[model samples]
Target chain A: MNRDGARSSIDVLERYSGETYGRALLGVYLAAPTVWLVSMYAGHAAAGFAAFLVIFAFGLAMDLALRRSSVVLYDERYERISRKASDAVFNVYGGGGFVVFVSLIALEFLGYYEMTPRVETLFLAWSAFVLSWGVCYTAFKSRA
Target chain B: MKNRLPELREREGISQAELAEAVDVTRQTINSIERERYDPSLELAFELATYFDATVEDIFLYEADEDGV
Candidate 1:
């Protein structure tokens, strides 16, 4: 038995996991739109802006619904599930950014692409790298 | 990883908030450990064990089966 045995009678409070989940919602919102915009303006206007907006709105609603309550931890397993999902996104985004950056550099060297003043590609690549590593530690390291 | 933090904490009759203050962590962090949702760094684990006047093994247990890795 441990000291907390006395307080054991106190029911565990379930805080909503969606507060963190809200971030994922925000990530998808940002990522999808940005990608769509890049593709459209870069040369795919066939992808209607209205269509992306509708899909983004639906995701926003889903995110809100998921984050409505704070009981993210129904049990240890639920925490694990959320952690894994979050980590997966972070890792993918991070690794993908690096690959894209290197490819972009190669393209530029070959005169296959031109640099745009409005888009600091290197900075975005760096941001994604740092963010992904941070999420990796926060999410996976917790399980350690 | 598994821990007996809640059990040790209860023996002192201190709330998670109080334990967190003593150990310099957030209450949520303490709760996360108690619920086995998160594992503290070795330094933090040692701090908790020391604060509780117990060995690390006395406070936290390692279960290979549950290893997230």
Candidate 2:
């Protein structure tokens, strides 16, 4: 053992600290509503566009904070907390997806949301949920 | 998975915090390693070796029986 008795076999994950993954996830998360907000304000021209810009800036700032806070390799307690949090996030989202899927199937069979926007919302929500969870799983699995 | 990490730590008269700092890791990591729930990377193995002035094998000997755990 080294003087401090730490073994060299432990793998510390330090990958993706750069903004690439964070930006990508943020872009995906913000795209739909930001686009809707922009579209909603399009009739107002400059005022609406300015509002969209402000909202987008706020969204980006939040994203930046999240990315900054996501720095996880330096501290052990933080790492454990992060792992548990990520696992909880994955499980919650996965459960939500399963519930949504079952509901959608039930609705289709029962002819409830056959022609309503409910179906479209389900599709959008499921897509976003799956995509976000996919990224989380990748990030978690890649951690050592 | 079972080894004499605690014994070794006691033998060296080192605290987990001191050992963690010296090894450039968190005390929990050393604790986890001792518990055998996790394995160290080659770099960490080398770090532990260099810290103890011993070979990696001296600190982390592997056993086939332990693998089934």
Candidate 3:
């Protein structure tokens, strides 16, 4: 390809990759909540498991697509900016989530709110996993 | 930190997109830099200076404190 053609292609790739990543991120949030709601209303363990499988498969596919696209599109500057943005977002999410979780626990202990041990454990595990994923992903992407 | 990015880019006959492409950043980042809403990292500043064939000091102007510290 000519110089201009290559440059344009790179631009297109960057845009496509960014959009795909954004959509995938949004999909995780939407799909998970929708599945949870569906499972809650359906009141069936099988239904919940099925929904979990579907969401997991979708997430895996998106992860693969993002990996492929990012490999082609990311440069040093892009990586640096992405790292900084990701870190900032992760810090806010982690810190805010921790405060909220502690407050909820305190309320539960004080009898102002009620939460089962199982539910509390699930919430903590899921949130910790997400926070760890964000941190790890940023570190991986920022690495040379 | 205030910068003369827009002026320099205009003088060089390049759009924000073009400058962003040359500097390996998003156009939004370039726009933010031009608007003085975002400050570039030292490495990015050096990259911009190198691309414009000028020193970083020539491109970015840092204002002194009112107390003159």
Candidate 4:
């Protein structure tokens, strides 16, 4: 392998350290405290602790299973492809955000619905952002 | 931007992945160049030329637009 490849591989090795569960340890700890604080602020102080435990365990399990499995060989071509994807993602978020904003305003005016600072709404928003970026990245990568 | 990247790779009897490893790039980059879907940057073009023991022009044939784009 070339010097860059070796360096990148070393980076991957360091990030995961081959102890899969160990990679998730910090995430698991952080998730509990963050979720507990959010839940407690939302008037579910006691429930937060229970939810925290579940989330902590879930994060560890899921991250151990899924994260750091593949080490991507990034190069100039990958960078070029991803730049196109990033441009597309920017457009998607810019245009899509405007549409969503207008739609929400219209819905509120029509008294059909109200956007709230709830977990589900937050998740949905996150899902839209994630899916748009994912789709753009995949499409550009495949096109190339 | 048209190139003989695939032909050169074939002449070398190596996989795109192998060349990519040799040059510290991803196989998809090579595939993209071979397919004419992406153009390589000057640095990469030089690297590829160096790897193939050829000048950049030997691998790539560039035809400018009518308006010289």
Can you list each candidate's DockQ? 0.05, 0.09, 0.31, 0.26
lDDT of 4 by residue, A36-89 (tens): 999999999899999898988887665544333432334566567788898898
For residue A69, give model 4's deviation from the true position in Å: 13
Off by over 4 Å in 4: A1-72, A99-144
Residue A27, model 1, lDDT = 78
Predicted candidate 3 versus true structure: per-residue lDDT over A47-117, tens digit per residue: 87678778877877665555544322344445667889988986777676677778888998899998779
For model 2, the superposed segments whose C-alpha errors exceed 4 Å read A1-88, A110-123, A132-144, B65-69
Tens-place lDDT digits, model 2, residues A1-144:
573332221222123332344455457557646665677766655565666577677766655544444332244444566889978987787787788778877888998856368767877787797797789779989994
Q: Candidate 2 DockQ score?
A: 0.09
Q: What's the candidate order when arranged by decreasing TM-score?
A: 3, 2, 4, 1
Clashing pairs in 4: none
Candidate 1 DockQ category? incorrect
User: lDDT tens digits, residues B4-66, model 2?
Assistant: 667778889998766776776666677788989767777877887888788888888788775
Candidate 4 lDDT at B11 equals 93
* Candidate 4 lDDT by residue in tens digits, B1-69: 899888999999999867876776666677788889889899989999999999999999999999999
Candidate 1 per-residue C-alpha lDDT over A12-108 given as tens digits, one digit per residue, 9 for 90 to 100 = 2223233344466667688767867876877875674765777688777655544333333123334555779977986687667668777877888
Which CAPRI quality tier does the interface of model 4 achieve? acceptable
Q: List the lowest-lDDT window of 10 residues for candidate 2 chain A.
A: A5-14
Which numbered prediction scores highest in TM-score against the true structure? 3
Per-residue error (Å), model 2, residue A29: 22
The TM-score that candidate 3 achieves is 0.52
